[model samples]
Target: MTIISVYYTAKMTDADHKELLEARLADIRRVGDTVNLLTVIEEGFESNAVRSKNERNFSKEVNPYVRKSAVVGATGMMKVTVASLKMFSKREIQEFDNETSATAWLRDELEVKA
Candidate 1:
């Protein structure tokens, strides 16, 4: 199984965030079915209506290409954001406290499916 990792850094502007999202989407399209690890360990998530909408759209756009997805370092409001994305995308996304565990879960999930 192919696994792709995408990281969101701390204190990103909306434009920066959108750029990363688009890049990830391109990777997903290129790779087809893939397991994804999204690390937001130091992300300073803020509530913004535009960003939220873009996130929802991204979730929808990437859903079909993602075979399994895991998120690391989602705490506080980030947890809520992840949950919302899962719901909106109707995709099962696992959450973990650290990247190692998240990657393990994603790998195991793909192995099981295989």
Candidate 2:
């Protein structure tokens, strides 16, 4: 199994966002060993934005390594949520609101890795 680091759980206030981003950066920078896998959990509008920005930031922070961007929110079944995710970008960023969707992505990526 690939090692993973979960950032933490919190609402996205401006200060918290700054602190979390810095901490995340530090965590990756300090990792003398490479991180093969990463997972982030987010909710709400502000949290969504924070996670989105974090994805971009972390993507830059961890160049050359493939990072998984799994956005967890109420999606699928209802077409609205899918539209929302699509709005983020043209790329099909895998999304989930619960374990089922998340695990599905995990399985898909893991198989590809194998």
Candidate 3:
């Protein structure tokens, strides 16, 4: 299994989200291993449209292939939205205020599966 960690430094557009996710998924397919995703959203989404689109895309298309995910650095509405989306994800999904806690949660999820 591999943990794919992505650190976001700037606001993410819809295309940026797709590109990053697809790149990671391609690597997972090539490696043929379970992947735990850790996304650190430092700057948030570019717009409400971008956030909604990405959320829909992730919940419908990308989440099934993921084993677990921990989203870090989300606060305010972002945190609330992410937390609410948990029902749409088949894999374990959680939000955190910091990378250390998010990474720890992902590791714990992996260990539990192991």
Candidate 4:
């Protein structure tokens, strides 16, 4: 599985999104595309426009490689952003208030045999 922790306090540029997507793609490739992801985002988006654009770009590129995703530490607009992303994605996307809960849910959802 691929796990990512994102913490930022400024607007993300297209290049930033591209670089992140490339990294995620590389991770997926390394895992042979059978991947679940846990993304803990802290203060990543400064505004709705930035969140929407970034998520849109991510959904286009990374969603195909993800089988499921758990988004932790999301609140307010970020919670809304995750919910909106769930609408168009074929893969499952869930939000949580903490990493523990998110990881537990992901384990259950993916039926991890560990």
Write down the TM-score of every candidate.
Answer: 0.80, 0.47, 0.73, 0.69
> Which lDDT tens digits does candidate 1 get at residues 1-114?
667777766778889888988887888788856556455446566647776777778788888777667887777766788887767665568777777777777777433231
CA-only RMSD, every prediction: 3.5, 6.2, 3.7, 4.3
List model 2 lDDT by residue over 2-113, tens digit each: 3344443446565666676667567666765544333445443334555556555655565433334444543223234335534654333454556455555654543322
Arrange candidates by TM-score, highest first: which order? 1, 3, 4, 2
Candidate 4 global Cα RMSD: 4.3
N/CA/C clash count, model 1: 0
**In candidate 4, where is summed lDDT lowest over 10 consecutive residues?**
1-10
Per-candidate Cα lDDT values, in order, are 0.71, 0.48, 0.69, 0.67
lDDT of 3 by residue, 30-107 (tens): 656678888787764433666566656655655656788888877666676677677666788877767887787778
Query: What number of clashing residue pairs does each candidate have, in the order they appear?
Result: 0, 0, 0, 0
Specify the poorest-scoring 10-residue window by lDDT in model 2. 73-82
Regions of model 2 farther than 4 Å from truth: 1-10, 32-42, 47-55, 74-93, 107-114
User: Which stretches of candidate 4 lie above 4 Å from their native place?
Assistant: 1-18, 43-45, 48-51, 109-114
Q: 50 in model 2: Cα distance from truth in Å? A: 8.8
Residue pairs with colliding backbones in model 1 are none
Model 1 residue 13 CA deviation in Å: 1.1
Q: Provide the global lDDT of candidate 2 against the true structure.
A: 0.48
Better of 2 and 4 by TM-score: 4
Query: lDDT per residue, candidate 4, 29-72, as tens digits?
Result: 67765567787766654446754676677667777677878887
User: Which candidate, 1 or 4, would have the higher TM-score against the true structure?
Assistant: 1
